[model samples]
Target: MSDMTMTAAVEAALPKAPFEGRHLIDGIWRGSDNGESFDRTSPSHGILVSRSARAGRAETEAAIGAARKAFDDGRWSRISGKERATLLLKVADLIEANVERMALLETLESGKPISQARGEISGAADLWRYAASLARTMHGDSHNSLGEDMLAMVLKEPIGVVSIITPWNFPFWILSQKLPFALAAGCTCVIKPSEMTPSTTVILGELLLQAGLPVGVVNIVLGFGQPVGALMAEHPDVDMVSFTGSTAVGKAIAAAASVTLKKVALELGGKNPQVVFPDADLESAADAITFGVYFNAGECCNSGSRIIVHEDIADTLVEKVVALSKKVAFGDPLNPETQVGAIISQAHQEKIAGYVKDALAAGARVKLGGAPVSHPGLPGRFFAPTVVTGVTADMAIAREEVFGPVLSVLTFRTLEEAIALTNDAAYGLSAGVWSENVHTCLAFARRAEAGTVWTNTWMDGFPEVAFGGYKQSGQGRENGHYGLEEFLEIKSVVMRVGRTRSNWVRA
Candidate 1:
């Protein structure tokens, strides 16, 4: 089907007028106190989709107050783990029920392909479900090894109110990454989703209510990062802050939250590398390489934006990647055939273009697409899938996180050189290696200065595994048992038998 037909069908299936883009505070949908609002334009068509309230310090304060009150009341936090698990499961069910609507809204706002959006929706539901299971299974430990004179134990308790700041790339998915675990840990939270894509997250408020979540347990404030996100990090009542965004912003948050010494978990940016060996399956590696960087228009934190190929197959692999890049369908996000859709905004598109231009000027060659694309019906921001060759490890394009669909290629003569090139980046979130030699792949994976490594595959992993970063990329894990533990504080208790106490000068 044509892009227009697909767009019409999706809109017909899920109408958009019913959604109210506003701050969800204490279970109420209200505008900012100053009545200031901003238009949210669809990236697919550059048309106004909704007018979202521009929340500021006032709203942030209100959200913090509501979360504090809810945490203090202990209405939700005092509940049994099984009860919280039941409610979380309900949320997962509700998300699955509205999968189509959720997927459509995400695509309309973010301009990712509808197919990928659907998969994200499913992944979110699974994430919530997994968190629900953790709610019941999570427990502390008792120890009798200290001595018969004393009884000791450790208890895991909620960390009170949390301020969660999510990014725009995967609006709902990233929020799901933090929210479910926080809720499972019996903590109240206030969410600050990226202003560029706040529609679906605002829509999620109603679903939370439908799932029987208590009011003020989950509050949402919509606005730009400066006031909303900044206020959240510095709020005194907030016991912890969890953020997912650029490394620079994450650093700012860390510095701000340090004043109160609150627990902070940051999932920051990455400049991931994909290393291809001479003995690897060239075709499969090529496909994985393309998907690694191009998926979500390469606007992923752990995207394999850098490729380090062995010199022997470097030329042939570059040719294959360039050929695959040319075939990437760029059009309306609703179309199933469209591999890449509109970028988040025109400014971001220009930023990506600037990166490519700078790389070209710095003695690099554009092996494939290197410019913006203009389609007849799709009037929004769009950039072509790009690949650059002859880039050094020190180039700006090679060093910085462009966060767009632009991959830079670098050649290495030996395994040691490839490892060094991959580890040269400051950020170390993830890496991809393609090699038929198991010993070599294992050794490279062990030596790579990244949090996670994919062997012969990219971005293939389960939620049960812990995922995080090293160096400047991030601080803590985001999934598995570790993710749930991030929201809880450990308390050690010791008791004296028969009221025995050590007396020195008194008593």
Candidate 2:
């Protein structure tokens, strides 16, 4: 399809009115007590897409209080596992029923392709369903052989009120990654979604209410991180904080939560790399590399933004990857045909451009697009798919998280060198190795410092598999059975029958 046709189609699909959202506190929808508000413009369309109540200290505190009360009073925390599972399954059904609506807002607010947004929203239902299964199957351990008249048991109990903060790139998906798991563990929560992509989270709130969740079991406060997220992290009433965002912000949240010694689970930044060897299938590896760097315009924590290629095939692999990247569609997000969309904002676009510029000045060469480009009849910000060759290990572009659709190429001579280069980065969220040899794949998998290792593939995730990072990539895990355990505290109970226990003190 022509660019002009795609632009017109995107414009036609634009929402006629912005989504109006208010805070969901104590099961009631209400405006900010101080009458503060914020507006979110569609990053792909340059038009207002949502207007949300800007929560302040009062609203944040109130939400925290409500969650604390609900958890302490056992409104949700003491419910039967079957009851929680039933509620979660209903939510999953409701989410699937409203997939198109949620996907549209997500695409507009986050500038991801509408098709990808639909897939993410639709797939999020699976997370809720998986969490439901966890709710039913969750168990504790019991010891029956301690003695004839004595027994010991270990119980998994809810961690009380939790604070969940999600990022903008995959707002709905990430929230599902946390909220459902927390709920499955019988914990009440206060949520703070990124202001840039707040609408979909608000819509999730509606679905939760429609599913008949009790008051204060789930509360959402909308605003910037300074007040809304800061309060959620540090509040004395909260027992845990689960955050997904930049590494810098994760550190701040950790510091704030430390004052009260609350538990903190963070899925932070990643400068993940995909290592390619000579014996690998060049065609398949090149295609996966292209998809990895450009997916969601590379505004992802797991973006394969850098590649470590064996020097033997570096030139050939770079040629194939560049050609494949050029074929990937980049344009209006509302158009189903467009594979890549706008940058989140003009400032982010500039930041991406600045990285390429600095790399060039530092002796790197741009083999493909290295600057921002305009789309026909579109006012939104966009950066072309960029690939930089001759990038050294010390270059900022190679080491830092650019968070854009920019790929850096570096060469390694041996398997040892490849693994070393991959592990050199400060962030170790994930890594991928492409090769036909079993020894090579296993060695890379075992030696890599990342939380997840992909052999002959990239970015393939399931709700049943655990995910998180190591080192500066942040602490804790999300998804799978481990995700549910993140919101639980273990307690040990000892019982003595027939009053057989001896007393140390004289009666």
Give the Cα lDDT of each candidate.
Answer: 0.88, 0.93
> How does candidate 1 score on lDDT?
0.88
Winner by lDDT: 2
User: lDDT tens string, model 1, 291-343?
Assistant: 88889999999888999999999999988987777767777788877777779
Clashes of 1: 0
Model 2's lDDT to the true fold?
Answer: 0.93
Which 10 consecutive positions of candidate 2 have the poorest summed lDDT? 1-10
Q: Model 1, stretches more than 4 Å misplaced? A: 1-19
Point out where model 2 deviates above 4 Å. Answer: 1-11
The per-residue C-alpha lDDT of model 1 at residue 367 equals 78
- Show the colliding residue pairs in model 2: none
* lDDT, residue 268, model 1: 94
